[model samples]
Target: MNNIELLKSSMINIVENKYSFKNNGLFQTDIPNLDFYFSSEPTEFNAIIYEPSLCIILQGSKAVGFGEELYSYDYSKYLLSSTHVPAKVKILEASEEVPYASLRIKFELEDIYDVIKNIDTNKLAMNVKSEKGLFFDDLTEKLYEPVSRLIKLIDKTKEEMDYLAPLIIKEILFILINDKSGYFLNKFAMEGTVSNKIVHAITEIKENFNEKLNVKELARLIDMSESSLYQNFKTITSMSPIQFQKKIRLEEAKLMLLNQNVEASEVAFAVGYESPSQFSREYSRMFGMSPKAHAIYLREEVS
Candidate 1:
């Protein structure tokens, strides 16, 4: 078999062995930045936070929607989220015989900055139109080999991991910076771009999601007009700022209710919803169930 085929086989083996118990969810790895995912069957669309990360599917397909754009990635392609964006994702292909399995590596903004700073500026500039924060591209041998090496390190000693993981991660970053899609991400490191400004607003929203957001102030902070901010932000994230905040608030409320068994009203307030009725209405709309019912369902699933 070819190297790509071999890498896929190895990735499937490692994930199936390590994540045998988790059939349709994320499984954390010992590596700080890496996470493994599996799905035994197709899943309905669900809201999720897409952090700055890269993901490669070894066996199945996934569809991620942000605003009007729907991105599909399978074994032949990989997904990249250059910045944090709230999106609805679904497992499009999986079965008992060929389960969906993938690996994701989360990287910090600083990592991208480091890559851009060290690389030649002339080489970085291209005429590519700025796309959304997310991208999908064909898989390449250069990315596959380093990812395979990183997964192999799961069996190594802590001393070896301590010494090797960072080197591998840096290598992956180098590959990403040199890749064609790197242009989508490279704009983030450039200071005066509209994409960079939107990212700034996103960071602020994430940091203070629970507080009431002032759109005028946010636009001023980013040195853009209110209309421009809304248009460009939605273009990149597929959601208006208020919509983004509400998505995060409801997501956080779901976690709090699921983990702590807190009253829905309390959870709603904690996540910045002033009215319990409004929270329940919006929560039901997003998650397809009232908070109480969703929490109970989640509890039953875990039990």
Candidate 2:
């Protein structure tokens, strides 16, 4: 087998052995901020907070939608969420015999900055396009070694994990930033950069999606002018501020409706919509059904 095939086999073995076979879903590992997933079925787009992390799909394929663009990755590529953003994830492929096995390492923004600080910034290629909050890059052998090494630490002693796991995490981030994606990662990591400011905007909207958004106030908080914030924010998130807020609110409402037993009007009010009619209208438009019907559809999907 080639290097990627070998890595996949190793990863599948580790996850399958580590997890109990009672069910198939996200299985948190002993490592902090590191987790694994084993799934045997495809799913509709599920909204989530995509943290700044590195994700590798060892077996099946996956795709995440940031705004309108859906970025897909598999064994040959790694998905990077440079900023914390609201996203929708869909498992594109999985089966009983060939389940979707993947791992995600959620790292802090400061950790990325610390890695870049040690490496001489002058050496990094600076011309790469600063893409959206989430992106895909080719997975190389260099990158795979550290990731595999990190997973190997899962069954080790806590003291060993405390001392070595972090070093491996930093090493993985270092390899990522030194590659073509470095420019985009570096741009978002630093303060005062346009992308960084836009990230701040995204965080604010996410935090207070229920509140009425004041675009000018958001720009001021991030030290940006309104037009500049709008342009750069759309360039990164692929939607305007109001549109982004609406999507997040709706996603949050869907999350609540699916998890909580509540009326659609209650969810609308909780998610900041003033009128139940308007909420029902928008929810139907976005989800292709009324809130109650959509909930039934999702429930039927699970059963």
Candidate 3:
């Protein structure tokens, strides 16, 4: 078989053996940096917080929407996100005969930095405008080989995994830095760059999800004017600062409602909404159900 086909075969084998559940869910891998996702059929778009990671599709198509753009990738393609961005995702292709299977591999700033440190930074462009933090690119054999071995490492002896996993991961990072889409990620990793500054703002909004957010203050903190901050932040995250904060709040509220035996009203307040009605209205708009109803639905889904 060809390299691409061989890689897919290996991915399908690992996924079927480790994450064969009929329902849609994330299956944790032996490595902390990796996870497998399975979906049996098409699903509605659901809000998600995507960390810095690379998502490789093994067998089906998926759609990830952020702000006004929707990115779709299948077995021949992969998605990369350089920052923690909130997005909406849906499994667009799957069934009993062919389930949607994919892998999510986490990456850290340190990984990117380590790979770029020895490279000549002068060759990297600095004037590139920040677009959406994530991009879809065609998968290459250069990337897939390492991924294949990484999957095989999961079933290896503990000593083999501990010694080989990091090396494989570093190779993956090296491949990413040389990818056509690496320009955006490289810009993100460079110290004191505009993209890095905007990342700081994104981090602040996420960490202070429950606190009052002032765009003016955030701009000042990032040492940029409000207009510059607004443009770059939207360019990178695809949402206004306030919109991002609201998403963070509602996402946190959803987790609390689903995991804790708390009332919807209490969740609203805990997530920084002063008026429960306002919270309910916004929550329904985003999730398509009342918080209480959604919580119940999730419970029934698992049970």
Candidate 4:
């Protein structure tokens, strides 16, 4: 069989025999920078603050998108996010017998610069207008090989694996840097670029999700005009600044409800909602359930 075929076969074997399909959810592997995800059935678009990472599908297909722009991919393609962006991910295909399996390799922005500085300038200049932070590229054999190797390293001893994992990850990053995705990656990694500045604006908003969203202040913080910030923020995140902040607030509130036994009203106030009734209205609209009801549902789910 070809290498790609071999990679998928072994991945299924390792996941079943090694991990035993543990929780049917996100699996944090021993590798500090790597993780595996599984879902037994199709799911709705889950709004999340996607981190910088390279995600590859092993057994099923998926999509990551924001606003009206949706990118769908399977084993034959890979998804790359060069910076943190507000987006939604959905499992398009999966079942109990053959669940959706995928792996993610996380990297920091600084992790990218070392490779960027060493890349050929001519290649670096190829795709400079990275209006969006996310992209889906055809997964060539050249890209698949390192990913296969990364999957295999999950079985190695900590000492040996630690020494080798970074090398393989860097190799993968290097390959992407030389491909079309490099345009987006480099755009975000470079200092003073509009994409990077937007990243800063996003960081500020996320760090202070409980506070009111001030478009003028955020634009000034990123050294851009209000019109420019609003336009580009929507362009990159597929939503306006206020929309992104609202999603963050509600998502955070839901997480708090699921993990803690806090009152819905309490969570509403804590996440910057001045009126509990308003929070309940917005929360129910987004999540399809009242906050208090959602909390009870989570409690029943846990029991």
Candidate 5:
């Protein structure tokens, strides 16, 4: 069969199996580190923070903004995020006729290291320097097979699943390590590398997102010069330190607005925005509506 036909078939089977489980915003497989989503409608402007994961869209398209760069991925392309960076994501297209279906496999640095130790290092290409948190790469049939097998394993009994998922997981990583962007993944997994240091800064920002930060202090914390820190931070996150902080702040404010009846001013302060007007301005720009209006619209949709 042709590649398109193969992908369609695999997607159909996967969605059928996904529906067998309890329906939610996201679904995790019986195996650890495997999850999929069947989003019936497009998502709104929101930032999701997650660790290194591979995301493949079987149908429809998504637009993800990391720092300043926006990336769109469809069936022909896949997204690989090597670090946990805050970013906005909106599902640009989806419907009952063509629902948005995606599979995300989370990879642990330890797991990648273990696989690297066993494999021949000479097979990997030279490391490539990249600044964007999101990467879009062409998908191949060989990459599809391992993912398809993992989805198929969802139907197996617990005993069969326990035995087979790890092998499949390792195979998936092997395919990724040999792909065009494999070096980025490889560098991320290595200790004491520039990529590793940047990963550390990302972790600090995520853990202390609510706190006011100083660039020099953060640079010292990560043991890098101010210039080196600024360059590396912008490279990996696609935004400067202040910009990353604002993204996190805005995302937090959005959650508060949706989940609570708190005043906009209170939400702004809570998210580290000292000026409510500044928060409102940034919120309107990001969501294309004012904070109060956006909240009301969201509430009306739910009601």
Candidate 6:
């Protein structure tokens, strides 16, 4: 078999042999905030909103839609999200013979900042954009080796986990920073950096998504000019500030509708829309179906 096929086979073997699948569709490990998965069926369309994280797929393929942009990657690629963004992801390919397996590592900004303190700043690239939050890169053998090793650690005893997991995690981050796209990762660690400012703005919007927000006020809050905020907000989030807020609102609405059976009008008002008609218009545009219809579709799919 070719290299890609070999990598796929090895990854599937490691996951199935070393880890036990949990009810939540992930394999548990001793390491906190780290999960693994091996799947053989296409995943349903779902939204993922999370902090800085890395996802490496060892086999099969998945598609992620961020705003109007769609990214598809397989065994040959990996994905990184530096900020919380509303995205719809679906596994496009998997099978019992060639299951789709992935490793997901979540980390706090402070941990990364602590690690950056000892590293030389000169190692990072000079030019980095604040608004470029998601990235995908080609996978190499070097990168795959450590992932394989990390999976092996799952079989070790608790004592071994304490001594070995931290080292493995550090090494993984080191590899990421040393790669060609390391500049983006580096920017995430720098305080008061442009990317950090954008992150701050994102935090504000997330916390106050239901509140009426104006461009001028948000720009002032982040110490940026309104025009600059508009430009950079689009750059970092791939959407304008209003668009970003609407995306967050719609995502939350989807969750509420699915879990709480919230009426469409109540959901609209709860998420900051003063006009139900306008909310429905935007919601349908983003999700492809009206809120009521989407809710029904989700319920049927889950049932």
- TM per prediction: 0.95, 0.87, 0.95, 0.92, 0.82, 0.81
Model 2 steric clash pairs: none
Q: Model 4, 162: alpha-carbon shift in Å?
A: 3.2
Where does candidate 1 clash, by residue pair? none
Local distance difference test, candidate 4: 0.83
* Off by more than 4 A, model 3: 21-23
Candidate with better lDDT, 2 vs 6:
2
Candidate 5, superposed: residue stretches over 4 Å from native: 20-32, 39-51, 63-72, 86-93, 127-130, 157-167, 299-303
- lDDT: worst 10-residue window of model 1: 122-131
| Candidates' C-alpha lDDT | 0.85, 0.83, 0.86, 0.83, 0.79, 0.77
Ranking by lDDT: 3, 1, 2, 4, 5, 6
Tens-digit lDDT string for candidate 2 (51-121): 78998988789888877677787888988888766677899998888878888999987998999888888
2 or 5: which has the higher TM-score?
A: 2
Residue-wise C-alpha lDDT for candidate 6, range 1-303, written one tens digit per residue: 866567656766766776632222566578775687666788877766756887888667899987788889987888877777667788899876666777787766666666667677687786745656888999877777777677777777878877887777777777877786577877866777777777888889989999987888888887888888888778877788887888789888888888886799999999999999999999898788999999998788566
Across 115-153, the per-residue lDDT of candidate 4 in tens digits comes to 888977466654434387777888888888887788787
| Candidate 2 vs 3: which has more lDDT | 3
lDDT of 1 by residue, 1-303 (tens): 898998878877876777673467778877888888888898999889889998888888989988877878889988888888888899999888888888898988778877778887667656433457888888998899999999988778888887898888878988988888767778865777788888899999988989999999999999999999998888788889999989889888888987996899999889998999999999999999999999999888667
* Runs in model 1 lying further than 4 Å from the true structure: 126-130
Worst 10 contiguous positions by lDDT, candidate 6: 19-28
Better of 1 and 6 by lDDT: 1
As a whole number from 0 to 100, the lDDT of residue 31 in candidate 5 is 81
Residues 1-303 of candidate 3 have per-residue lDDT tens digits of 898898889768866876674657788877878888888888999899899998998887989998888888899988998998889999999998888888888988778888889776666655757677887889988999999999887787878888888888888988877777667778888877788888889989999989999999999998999999999998888888999999999999988987899999999999999999999999999999999999998888767
lDDT of 1: 0.85
Candidate number achieving the greatest lDDT relative to the actual structure? 3
